[model samples]
Target: MGFLSSLLGIIGFGIGLPIGLLVGFFFFVYSKPKQVQDPVVRPLEECDTTVLPDLLPEIPIWVKDPDYERAICREIRRQAEPILAEYSEKYKIKAIEFENLDLGTLPPTINGIRVYETNEKELVMEPVIKWAGNPNIILVLKLLSLQITLQLVDLQVFFAPRMTLKPLVPTFPCFANILVSLMERPHVDFGMKVLGGDIMSIPGLYQFIQVVRAFKLMKADFLGLSDPYVKLNLTGESLPGKKTTIKKKTLNPEWNENFKFVVREHQSQALQIQVFDWDKVGGDDRLGMQLVPLKLVTPHETKEFNLDLLKHTNISVHNDKKYRGTIVLELTYAPFREDSTSALSAKFDQMDSIIYRSSSNETLSKAGLLSVLVEAAEDLEGERHNNPYALILFRGEQKKTKLLRKTRNPLWNEEFQFALEEPPLLDKIRIEVLSKRTGIRFRSKESLGHVEINLDDVVRNGRINQKYHLINSKNGQLHVEIEWTMV
Candidate 1:
């Protein structure tokens, strides 16, 4: 009986102990809240791809157009309205209607008298010229050109002009020495809030919207209509094929109404002219001249001169000591042609054309700029080639930075400008000059001081005309203009 009782008690304790422990453990665990993982958030969609149905205007005509200028303006309106909406909220200000206008205002970039138009809040210009020495460059402002209007809750209404400047240009003012002051500097914090950190403001970042606009403004054409933006002042220079004897060209009554000029009998030295022309048709003259001279056989080549050349050519005084067989020119006039051809090729039809399209009566972009742009491309043409055309571009003069092989993508024509790989540091630019079908051997050499580039139609010249009259007529000669941008 004792053995039976003991065995039974031991068995009961063994089973009951384990069961009691398990029950208590389960109750303790269940008493507390169940553990749960936190919810994750899908990151905000990218702003670039963020489809704001009301973001851009319903009319996408500007987007379809290849011109970024129009697109930028529309983008300004698209972007500005929202920012202003947010800006008003942040500053606790109401965006009021635009007001005030002055056309006789000028911003700093205007080297000469600048012509500016504004909604009394912002300044927009058709053409702005900034002379950075050597190159007299023109700038056609490609921006929304808008001014702003704000309200301080019945206290006062204010207006501001949006600035038109690149990011770095405003940051480091003294480095470039540009005419315009650092555009009303962006509150970098404000700018950062609008533009994310992923971007380093490159050349054109108006969308980052740092440009300061004006409410009251004035603009003037530093130089009026027909006033030459560039000029050649040839003062006290030597001419080719002359010494002390003055050769004279005279009109004879007996001759068939022709004027004749004669070279002196004793003078054998070549006359050289020094050309001082603007470096760029637009922008600053940051381009450095490199005279890649063709191999010269002798130290003394007969020189020639011509008037009415698009670019002013200057000839240096022939150095008698280290005489070379190359004719020297002093270039005083800058090339004005945008396309290789002459400007007269394109004629604007003044009869019927839409000038600048306006948004509001106070729109910064208006009829003025549009009026000037008309007929700019009437006569423009690309480089003509018979065979497959390949475009070549060099970031620097060195072959290392050169694009070994390039094929152009024709923009509007069969010929397209080559977009070269940017050099690690943008140091220089070199391009291959071609004269096809003109049967001319153009010689260009990059050198210092003694720089001279000559295009000679060896086969056709001498039989046709003594001067470049034939070359000019065939449109065989192309001009090169340099422009500068601070990246």
Candidate 2:
């Protein structure tokens, strides 16, 4: 009994000693008070305050279809209300009273406007509000976060006739850059919470969802012994193309390759597959190319297709006649659809009888308008004194800006409007900046440099305001903005 008692004491000491030391150290280190620093507060300035004047109002916009615009505004408010409710609770703010909120009063401008109605990332538009009257009014008024989404399936949105907000600051002078969305159509949104670390819980942003497609590059019946490999592209910007592993020296090479692409809209885009023959000596030889329209795919269902590879031809031939070989492919579109109680619950009509549905076709065909603002050009290279003028081309319609004389950098803040029923999304908008001749005749025009922008980018991104690198030159860039409106 004495030995057992002594042994128990030793065991208890062994265990308790270490634990006591650990606890002592933890409290000794963590129990100390932390120094809290006072936050620096900056006073708001009044006089000479640079207000980003509503750029939308300066450009007068006309909407032909008032009913369509009203429908879009109604949908936008519906989707935004619940989102505002969540924001109000999370931020501990007063209940957002949208009973007085009307689409007729919302600002109709492209300034700080973003559409979050695709399978893309969750759109959080932060509109900064400036107090025009009582500074202390900020304490009483709670600023709510605005999230914009489209209620349509095809992911189309009407952005004209911007809504105005007046009741939010009826007593106080408050200016907020409210972000709202007016939608038309949608594609696929599975409402995924995490995709490769992306939070795509939203209903409509295209980037939130992805499509998995498999290509069975079964036997290429080429004329020669070629090491065949396949390259896939989404056919928009110069995104890096995907390629399959090269199969060794056989004309009939079978390459089963799988690839994934982020889809924006259904019928507005296509996947371009180009087969090339691998070579050790020189550049890879072009075997054949084929295009698969994205509109043919159904969400959550796998479909197989035998696509015929077509040889390069100057004349346009039907897909049946154009042949190099056939590629057996399988594709599945995985979209993220948020469950009920989510911010967006837009019911879209399934696409039926709509052939070649695109922003140019389904939405823009009836009443479509395109506005191109030619802002400026920088770092142009060529002669010492170059008089630069811009030639803009879309489909068959062409417009030119007034010439800016004898300057390497030209600033022509000009806007051109294109009235159209259907726009060709596959075609490129050609912009060529030319310099008038200075010599004896001085009548001929010289191509300083040119920029070709894919119209699909303009259609997808709502408004494109960026500088494009000039082609056929080492250095030069053109600043341009494109806005699309559907009446």
Candidate 3:
């Protein structure tokens, strides 16, 4: 009876253990939570590390508010003020004022934006930004007695990567990422100039002319005894060609015509002379021609040319060995000199007596102080807009007046001083009125008019307050006063 009972208990234990294992497996599978995901958003910095981003994200709706615009302006000023302070501290300029900053042609806007993926590491955006507007930036800088106004429009700004933001200055941090991306490409071009114009632009100096006095041409025409004339032309110059009167029925014709040409740039100038035979029925026949360069002649020296005329192919005469004709002319060149147009000639008309007086005594030579007072100007040339300013140059030193905006007339009552070691008789002062172009892409200076004042007249009169006419212009006059004091 005991053995029978043990067998039945073992069978029951095995069945119970198997059932317990099955129940625990089903519970583990049903109780665990399912894996879930949330939507992802990436900032501009999260663009792919290996690939460059081609799209810009849309601006948020909040950025379009007027309050945001004001904030941006405030931030720009706050950043710029410290930089300007550094410049002022350098002492190159005395004081500076940052007056106004406003939107230019086009405003800022954003099109749209989108995000994808669960990694929160990448995003694609479509941003529309048209930075077309005239941003007004009025900068007033005080240097000496001059009050200069620099109007900067359409300001383009950029930021470099790894730049640090100073403390206490409010800024838009989002722009930092955008500006950094822009650093990958070049944006601006820098240029520098040492001098304004050529040496001919100096005051008091003059350019003389080269005069050619032609006499006659001998046997110029290939055909026998043809009516001939001489024509003088300036190669590479726009001046009218000079011609001699036609001599009827003569192989050797005499002209006695004088032709003069200004020697502006001597190296690029040449004289061309052509002899032509007159015809009653058909076109005139070419006899011969010769070209002479202006650089071969010395200044203030007279030279003679009896050149043999040749054809366009450099051939004198194809059939006749003695078909050559010579042209006789006297060439004289008078170049610029310091005393050429100097008013000193008018002041010391009796140069011989003055030289004798100076040799007699050296005590008459005394140093003095020179004063120039610039008053105003009127009838300046302009079309669309004009920002006129005055530039004064003396002995290679230069100074400027404040800019006057949008006017045909400008007033600048300014004073300047110079200490002379010698007499002011030899010096000349140049004053140029220029119009400043404020366009962002087109920044240049247009000359309104200019005047050169000889100091000899000012020294002789002690003080000269008069209106001077502008050069190379029909209208415009400048008022100025000069005084010389013996110190």
Candidate 4:
């Protein structure tokens, strides 16, 4: 009897729960308030100016923030089409066109702003931004015989970024430079629809979106023993290649080095990466090499590659089987700016009267200004007195720096300039460090060390900052910076 009573009670409770839910849902759907009023719309002139301040707290923050100004979506779309077309041509896409682009009336909101005060020529602020927008942006892509349509919907983003306006001036813009930096990883959410079906809802596709969103925040091998170093250069260039420091006695070495090169012709140029085994007493041995064509890299985009090293760039049946090793690299190419290119052209045109042409079909480069800076010297020593000064000689001109007395390390920070009618492609500059005796001595001045550098690399590469080991000196080095600018 007790079991039957418990079973009956359980049935009654289960039945009553659904009935109560139905009654509550019915009231929630059908109930109306005692007082209801339609919203009133008025013109701006009729609204009281004094009451506007009271409604500030009730209005949305995005509407009141100056940073949340409405964007001209039509102008943005017009400007973006040409850039998209350029990228499409680079990737060999048949066609890429915008089907529809409307960045709705909504704008990003600034939740908070923090300003920093410093005794410098800069203004810094950090703003927390949140944006949930309904934008209709559709893209149509064609590849060979296939055509694809992509639609973006329900986009959201949240980020905190620091902005800096530096070196305030009395000019129109007031700031010389504006810098923007992210404090942390940004959160982005969006839905992509392809062919009117939501692709984000598909299995495994959502993970791809997460992977791409996370990407926004964005090697070696050896035989028994080797001290590996890498040399990087662009092919078809006359300048010397950049190199990494040697890692000693390791089977696997990681030289996380950064290098920049001026690329004149991206379609014909290739980056040559060569690895070598450094030796203390003898010449370095070539370990392996690889070539990365510049055309394969998109401008201003970083791409990673784990490439297999080869004996030479000529890949053959024999070279394919050789297991040299693999190299990991991040490559980015930036195209030359139009203003700089035009300025260089104008300089060349101005120096056309002085341009020299040889009988061997060789033409001299245009005139350029050469700058030499004697920064400092390290570990320099003299026999008599360590009162060291630097003497710079270029062509027929000579310059000298102030002598520092009784110091093994001296910082001159002196700069010298040379005006020339043509590039010094085959010329060389000599820098000698000499020490002068303060008191009476047999020899007033003595040579500490001297170095001669060829100007070919400086002219080709535009600028070079290097520490050169002094000739005929033990553990002495000279720091120098050279810059060549077309006049």
Candidate 5:
């Protein structure tokens, strides 16, 4: 009797479970809410325009800010089609075109614009852009044997960018260049659908989108529509300034060039940058110029500048009206070592004591090393064969460089050292360029050019790198670097 009752109970439970499940499914499918309202629809022509004012309170905070401005969505959509088509072609697609492209009526908003007030001739503004747009952009792509449709929906982007309009002038469209850079990583969110199925809805795909969307903003800077080169030098020095290679026939050129200069007094010295448009026939035109004071930079640290190009160093009301573009560069100042600085200080103190004790008419002498580096000679023409060499003559001591055979421009890069008991303040060094022929000619040797350089400036400035014109030769120049270091 007990076994039969248990079997009957199990059979009744199995039958009731299915019946209950079917009843619940039926109610769930047929159930209706207690409250139901139909969505209101209106025709586009009959829509009331005055209702926009009532909806102002529901707008975003960026829309209410006075500094915020709406982005031109229509123009952006128009310009993006060709760029997208080009990108599709790059991927070897047979045909790709935008069937529907609209950024929608709700444009991207600038949260706020912060303008900086600086003494320099640049206008800097930082704008925060926040966009949560309902865009309908669809692209139709045709591969070799297949066609696909892609749709973009529910897009959002947020970023802060620094915009700079440099060298403000009085003319129309006052700024010469516009530079844009991202301040931080951008945030982008969107939904992408392919063939009526959302591909972005796949698991673990959003993380990849995050990485792909992180990118930098491109700068809108412009250069002169000519060949451009840069000359960099330190002020108060007669050095042959360092030069960058010329870029040909390009309005926008990039020269990631580096240079170093010997700084005597960082407090008073300044860096001068001169940009010129290269011309093969005549003199190069002056594109722009700027001066950066060394005192503004901290030693041992690198600093960057986007300096606005100017007519000259002397800033005036009239010159401010000229727009000469801009230059971007990095500068670093490295001072002498601690031991060298202490040794230099002791030498200066000893010189001061000697000046106080000695008579004013007596000559003061200090032991130092004089280094003369003959780099090269340019445009050297000898009356005979042009196998050129350089001769350096100091206080009755002469040093000569290796003779290079048959070259108008010879690079010797030779260094000569002279241990001197006194600075060559009142003295002069004579450098002569002479050529010797290998075979017997009318004259075996001939003088190309010679120059006599005074040593007063080198003694005062510690170093001088300059190209001096030859005294007797036409269109000849000698490159020399002289350094006076305390022993």
Candidate 6:
């Protein structure tokens, strides 16, 4: 009876445990929600939406929301600022604004960039770049200015590559990358220049942040951008609006600038040039050019770059064909910017005129009607293009006379009598001797047929029975000889 009672108790306990666990599980499954310690959803009444994102330092360049370039600049500043501030203590320089620089028909020179009118003066730019970032980041930044010419160019910057410009400005330590811009009118060429070196290199990240703080304090770009865009002085009169011209007497950079720059075109304008024998050779550096600067005489009264004649001389001819040096002035001025077209360069009145000259070497081919095929380069005679182009030049004193093209004429046996309209200053006569299949022999002491010449009083003829100097009669050759003046 005791064993049966123990067994009954165990069975009853097992049955109660399973039932209790099942009931508790069902109750827990349908229980109340568990509360979060901190609520993430903010109440609408307490939300603050007064400050705008553009006001943030990360979006400094975006003055307007839609401009893509502004957005890109902002992003660049945001990303590069941290890495730049590592080494420098002072601020990084922002962008520089160049506006209303002139491109008056004439080309400038290397030195002319110094002043507005003449390469005699130099070009100096004050930039304007507005941004909000750590002033320290300015250390890695550069503000470069390049001076250019037809042959070569140089660069100047806020700072050197590896070194700072503290000596130039004792209080400030800055560096820049001088970028030389070789401009072909509306287009700018970057491959023409050479970059100096890299900026400051810092070791730690926290130190770089301090450098950015310093850059925020320097607002140098404001100095460059404050000036207005200069307008073209058409009508020879200053427009009724703002006076853009800086007086020639004042001789200073007033309110005029441009960003894309090549070398100056006016540097050679002031030079006093004399075209002798188809070559222009100036006396000295100072007397080499003759230049006139552009300026506003009065607000209402305008002035065209009227170059009637500073000084000149003419020739009196009595024949149908005329030949003389026609002294013409060279006009050099600036264009407003890239793609800028002012009616300044219109027709013959706007183009430069050079006195016509003929030389001994430049024998223009008698082809291409209206325009002859010249050897040496001709200046901008007709309507000139705004862009730069290639020029083919030749050496030796050559005449701008008519000549035949060297064609493969093997049976040129008859004496090619070249009748010059004028007596040629002949130094050498070139003959194209050739054969179809048989090549001309180099040099043998056997004469076949020869040449005859007569220069005014001098004369010579072919030999009869003498040992013939049988030149490239076997193969082909171009025989040329110096003109002998019989003394």
Best by lDDT: 4
- By TM-score, the better pick of 4 and 6 is 4
TM-score of 5: 0.30
What are the runs in model 2 whose C-alpha is more than 4 Å off? 1-223, 313-323, 340-487
TM-score of each: 0.16, 0.31, 0.30, 0.31, 0.30, 0.15
User: Which stretches of model 3 miss by more than 4 angstroms?
Assistant: 1-223, 313-322, 338-487
Model 4: per-residue Cα lDDT over 1-487, one tens digit each: 9999999999999999999999999999999968988899887569875455466554544454534433555577779889988867875777778888777779799976879999999999988787988788788877777775777776777677899999988764578888999865665546445542111111100000000000000022244577777888778866667788777776466766665565546677788888787877778788778788877877557777777777778766357565777777877644322112222323333211221112121223555467798877878878877999999999887889889988777667677767565778899999999999888879989888988999887876665677899998998899888866543
Query: How does each model score on lDDT?
Result: 0.24, 0.55, 0.59, 0.68, 0.67, 0.24
| Selected candidate, larger lDDT, 2 vs 4 | 4
| Per-residue lDDT over 402-422 for candidate 6, one digit per residue giving the tens place of the 0 to 100 score | 222222211111111222222
lDDT of 4 at 57: 50
Q: Any runs in candidate 5 off by more than 4 Å, and if so which?
A: 1-224, 338-370, 373-487
Q: What value of lDDT does candidate 4 attain over all alpha carbons?
A: 0.68
Q: Residue 233's C-alpha lDDT in candidate 5?
A: 76
Per-residue lDDT of model 1, residues 1-487, tens digit only: 9999999999999999999999999999888777999997454365433343335444244343446554554565566567646645543444422221111123224422334554443343333232222211111111233222211111111112234322223232312222343322211100001101111112110000011111111111233111111111112222221111111221110111111111121123122222121322553221111121211112123222221221222345332232111212321111111111122124323222212111222222111100000000111123443211212243332111111112121111111111111211223233232223334545322111111213112111100111111121233222222221111
Clashes of each: 69, 38, 6, 0, 0, 74
Per-model root-mean-square deviation over C-alphas: 26.1, 30.3, 22.9, 31.4, 35.8, 32.3
Residue pairs in collision within model 3: 104-133, 104-134, 105-132, 105-133, 105-134, 106-132
Q: Among all windows of ten consecutive residues in candidate 6, which has the lowest summed lDDT?
A: 206-215
lDDT tens digits, residues 375-475, model 3?
67778886545788889888786778778888776667666656455566878999998888776646467888899999876765455777899896569
Clashing pairs in 4: none
Total backbone collisions, model 6: 74
Q: Can you list the residue pairs that collide in candidate 5? A: none
